[model samples]
Target: MTPYAKIRVVDASTGRGIPLVELRTVNGIRHVTDSRGLVAFHEPGLMDREVFFHLKSPGYEREADGFGYRGVALTPRAGQEARVEMTRVNLAERLCRLTGQGIYRDTLLLGEAAPIPNPVLNGGVMGQDTAQAEIYRGKMMWFWGDTDRTSFPLGNFHTTGAIATLPKGGADQGIEFRYFTKPDGFVRAMIESKESLPIWVSGMAVLGKGSNESLYAYYAQVRSLSEIASSGYLKWNDAAERFDIAQTFAKDRGWRFLDGHTVQHEGYILGNDPPNVRVRADAESLLKAEAYEAYTCLDEKGEVRRIDGKPDYRWQKSLPPISSTIEARLVREGKLRAEETHFLPLDTEGKAVEIHNGSVHWNASRKRWIGIFGRKGGKDSALGEIVYAEADAPTGPFLYAVKVCDHPKYTFYNPVHHAFLDKGSTIYFEGTYTAEFSGNEDKTPLYNYNQLLYKLDLNDPRLAHAKT
Candidate 1:
């Protein structure tokens, strides 16, 4: 039996394996590095022949050869190994796949020891979507929408939950997940659905004192990808270790959903993507929709009024904060000018970096609010660009937004900055890396629609762009 040549791609400086590097043969045979940054090559016709391979990876670079081609010439031999090194160009360094199978597939295939104890499959889960997390019950409680199972095409759609010990390694070391699974071994629904529509959970947070601490999240029942039929809130049942519907809100309930990172400031939880809407940190205020207040410029009647063509940014009650969607509509309606917008941070190009979705947290090191957000309607690939920005306060004037991580032809969206995992100036974040919104149809094997973790140093000179 002939073993295929094992090709490995690693970071030139660290000599650590890099994931998602694309290598293409001169004739167009394409290969991507797996979680452990490996590709097992076995092209019989090209095995003996010296082939020119093109290297293409986002946030990484290799020098061009004499003919201006940035590729390597390799003569792959059976039962052998080859190595390629690339310099990480982006401030953010992609660590590994947080969800999905074959995390260390090729590394394991070569009989190498994996980083995590259970590298192949942790929860018997194939893949999972956007992660909503909170530090709860002395552990990191995580919930995700629409999980994929190894056994079938369909999977747990209501919600999937997992719990892990609070990360102490700043996420450079891969964190482990112990999934909430059913008897059949697939991830069980955090909350079972009684309707035909699927339930996707988000806005997870923990409330109350020590023994009285409780977990909660906002759930939306969807008729399709864009159409959410109904929305509601849920509470975690400590005894059953799952979520139960606490209150079902009407579909017209204005964007009072605590949708992203919830930061406690001045005894109130500032739920920020907008950071404008918030409720008192107490258990009772969080459950009541009317109790939440919006930091809006609107009058009591919920009307957008401009003073001398400028938005009067102020705190108003019972009104929704100007979200990205609302900002876009107001701009089109000539109610809000581009220059007066508050939430859309700007890149170095002086272009307003339209943000799709993201989370913000107060970083103690910087003493400023930091955000990791996905770009929207930019020249870059759709849903593939990520930007980092900071503000003096959680709600006002994000100085600048700069590119931190990028996926050339892939979609990496809904980036969640894990403030709980932050160590000094080093920040850890993760996002849903998928092919769904991306025009490319080639789903990354064992990795698509899953979370990919990345880390960045706030002191890095490259990030100085955003700081300015």
Candidate 2:
């Protein structure tokens, strides 16, 4: 049915397909691998001729030949098969893109087998940002930040969402999403707004159980890049198929409110990294700011209590916990010592690691609460690096961390570990990958601003530092 040839890219060590591997001909014709690490290449006049392709992928490399070229010369034939092996140098195995078009585009074009019902495009969504998921109404619902479309660059910024049947197999297998679409087939804004500014949502979760349950989240209206104009709580309106504002918070009242991906621990909803901020998992309590508590080190009047230059930690209401960023600042200011901090995570090299955004979950296999987050300032690729750390308790002295994934020149930020996808020692996490903060101009087609899911094994020898 087609003149395309199948070129499969796989990890040399595991022999599994390597997604996002790029191959380009001398003429600059580019082909990128799909979720299965397969590329369907069909170039006019290049078929059946010997063509040399330069291979490039993040954290992957091929041995150079005597000519010092890290490429291969292969004779392309219609419907024929080829294979290229790349060695993975990163700790976490980069899997596939979860948002945007062309997820399985190449695979579907060649009439070959591919995952997902809609392979080329779904719900007219070309690109989307950091997605948050929740188990609601018998299915998993996804809410993302801003989205881009095929029609134009200035797309929906009012928040978009989708629902999908949770996949049964491991995360190594591909996953699919069916968006909540409008009449025009574009993904409709999940959170409606009268204002012209954009809105983003997080901390989405279901409160109560069974027939009395209701879904809720925290929404922020953005005027510029990330400056929040106003923030409030939202409740799902099943009749309208979108979120409705539950209550609005005054200035500075948003901090103690629920934020980030939350987890239910002992009948309470835990929010943010280290699981410090929490509230009772009930409708009435979650809506009340006085009901929320944070594992903080401040006095009742909101003043820091220091004993011998170290903070005194306790669970307090109406006050959010001190962050690693604050710890770093306090350490630099002689108010706190690096050796005695409770919240700051240190790398295996014994240096303080700044966490930009991440998720913390209780891992059953590791039996330790693990934090997987994006390293804020890294020499490797700015926000592209991911690090993993563990604590005996959710409130960490998550002291030692290991660099789990690395992107030399690309930015992959806001990593979240999917507790629902845990398969013993094998864990899955995803983040928004983009060129926005990396200072890189060349963005990978169909991948920029989409979530890239990664798999990390706790049993891997490289993760030994995080064991204890």
Candidate 3:
């Protein structure tokens, strides 16, 4: 039994009691708030619990307990009063697939890299000789485990396999196929195999860069062309393990699929045809505002403009694409220097740039930054050498960052997350280690055993760091 609080939940709109409402918590406990909108619990175990409210009367819809609701921190004290209200819920308007806590799918697959001391190397499971991968659709996000080529005849028994996790709380592991193709937005992986066996491949989206310490995956299952008509949505789970909420939310209402390229939904398709906002940084607050002198080194070598003839200057609002002429006014007598734009490039166009999480500050040590790049070729993961860049600030106006890993014919290396240890000036980046799959490896096709994390000395000079 639970003790009830003598509280009243009056309707905000009608000012009437919302009688007999049941409240539930995330931990599977339920209590009822009375006609006056007051519900009480005897125990306060976890402060992190989220509560939900439901009414037993008609015309009243479910509600959630918000910050306004109060609970004792584990004492016999006056708890906070909870208010309840009802709103109409349209069955057709489901929660967004990307929103909420839900499971999408799960899959079983093996992960491996070359056995060499370095994760990147040729003639191994993943062919890339460097730690990098490119951003291309139809590329495999992860690969199945493969045999150790060194073990020869015995290695024959150890084959490779792949798996994909669907969005609806289910997984397809150990797919029985040799070649797999994913048509954007079709929701299913098309399989080409050695035998006519029913093969299934799990589908998942990688949430962040390929080199992040770990890939956060949302598993999704296939929705055949037939199922699309009845189920107005397609979905993937949070962890690619279980189906919890509708993944498509509302996007599926107007959905279409292209043979090889786009997944059309809500009048939009996925591609890089033109200039759009590809990447954005977190909003940053301005520290201060000021103005600085402008210059022109042309034949005259003089000021660009003058306020009143005395070396005119103005306070400026500086952001990315710092090569523009946007200036601010100096309200005070302080010298205003332009804030240097700090950003990382997304592609060759350099249109979409994001801020780099600064490097670790070393208390006592010299350091360098190594850049490795690669691309997927045919079936192998071909890679370039490790480039180098050095800067006092991890966020840089880097004089020279190595493009040692640049291979025009190969895909550019996709660097995930990087961490610099200020204590030792050591830097580490993790990502999938892949190269062109030569097709000579047994059992597994192209993407067999394709994940690896690379570590390097940030202060190493052989691989020169970018000069400031």
Candidate 4:
């Protein structure tokens, strides 16, 4: 008797049809499911023998089974299709590390495995932290906090500010070092002249619409290490070859700025009057002592209005307002205790888990807000465990988080999501990987004090049903 089979592939959790799933039979016949996840095939002289099927997809886990097993056997009736439910792969497995010239470069200009015995000049923008990546003008642009490696061997010696651009394709295509603050002749001159100004430019936020966009970089203005650290804001002047100081905090105010850390300028802008910007602020002594507070800003008249209705040119004068809505939801969902003063998600032990320099962005494919943050685990665990969380809205009731990547005995911080570089099912993010602050000096070769990329799939069931 002639044998024939019809198969329908679907997600195990959502039960939605998974398109383009490939299935191969033991007899060397291959069939790919269509948009509806249905595939049919026929073969003669196969009724007497047992048949097995192998399945494969990008976001779904692969499955293979031999004949005679009740669940694995393929015995489809004449007009009926056999349903094949494929489990979604975990987000961790889908993350692929990319290859590039690590954060530092030598005089020889070697690749990832270059030696650091005798470093003549600060090569390839030096080691950096808090990498902020964006896809601009058809290329990937990366801006990071350039550490002063000459000052100390430990991490984040001092931020000098760095920028690099990568060509199309992926990491294999290589990147071009565009700018470094310390190496730039003008910035070096300022530092050498003993000027009491900001030497490092970091915490960059790209603002404005297409063609009219501007890059706003943040700096801490200090004559000496002991002086009150103030938010020294700078705007990149393309016509001129330097970043000009846009705003500086008054010394008498005694305010320190913390979280202009990461900015989401796409839809958070409110009104047409120069557009109000939303900033995240962490409580220090300068502010009202509330942790992880959010503030609204208006950039039109060169003044930022705090939630208290006080306007000031300097960003520090504007105090971060409490986001009661998000705090209430988190408490209701048990993600935060009612007594906790911070807005970050709490661990099982009720400790306020710091996000450090995590990023939040919208996942268009999944129609949800996704975030990746550095989870501050206890001393015994890896300090660089990257956790993934999702929410219905940007300012969220982000209730649950799952650990996606665990680098035991190492330190990974400042996780940034590259939402513009996403390709439908697959999304990318990165962080500064090092052992400098982990208390254990053991470091991974070719990855110490450098940026590491992580790729996640939107179809992962763990992220899809994260709240559960």
Q: What is the C-alpha lDDT of each candidate?
A: 0.80, 0.83, 0.26, 0.49
List the lowest-lDDT window of 10 residues for candidate 4.
268-277
Please give, for residues 1-468, the per-residue lDDT of candidate 1 as tens digits.
446788989999889779988889988898888777888788869997788899988789989988889889888887788889999887798888888887877777667777677678867788889888788967888888888888888888888888865334436757788899888778888886678578988777688878889887878888998888888789999889998898888766776667766777778887757577788887678777788878766665655766886668876665667676666667678776665666777687887777787888888888888888888865657889999998877775665788998887889988899888888899889999889878989877677899998988898887776776
Query: Each model's number of backbone clashes?
Result: 0, 0, 55, 0
Error of 3 at 68 (Å): 79
TM-score of every candidate: 0.92, 0.94, 0.26, 0.55
Evaluated with TM-score, which candidate comes out highest?
Answer: 2
**Candidate 4: where is the Cα deviation over 4 Å?**
1-90, 93-126, 134-140, 148-168, 171-176, 180-203, 222-228, 252-261, 265-354, 378-382, 464-468
Better of 2 and 4 by TM-score: 2
Q: After superposing candidate 1, which stretches have Cα over 4 Å from the reference?
A: 1-4, 27-29, 42-49, 66-68, 78-80, 165-170, 299-310, 328-340
Better model by lDDT, 3 or 4? 4
Worst 10 residues of 1 by lDDT: 164-173
lDDT (0-100) at residue 56 of candidate 4? 60
lDDT of 2 by residue, 299-404 (tens): 7665568777667877777566777787778777876677666667777787888778788889989888888988878778989989998887777777778898
Decreasing TM-score order of the candidates? 2, 1, 4, 3
List ranges where model 3 is wrong by over 4 Å. 1-386, 390-395, 403-409, 417-423, 430-453, 463-467
- Give the Cα-based TM-score of candidate 2 against the true structure: 0.94
As a whole number from 0 to 100, the lDDT of residue 110 in candidate 4 is: 19
Per-residue lDDT value at 218 in model 3: 17
Angstrom error at residue 214, model 3: 14
lDDT score for candidate 3 against the true structure: 0.26
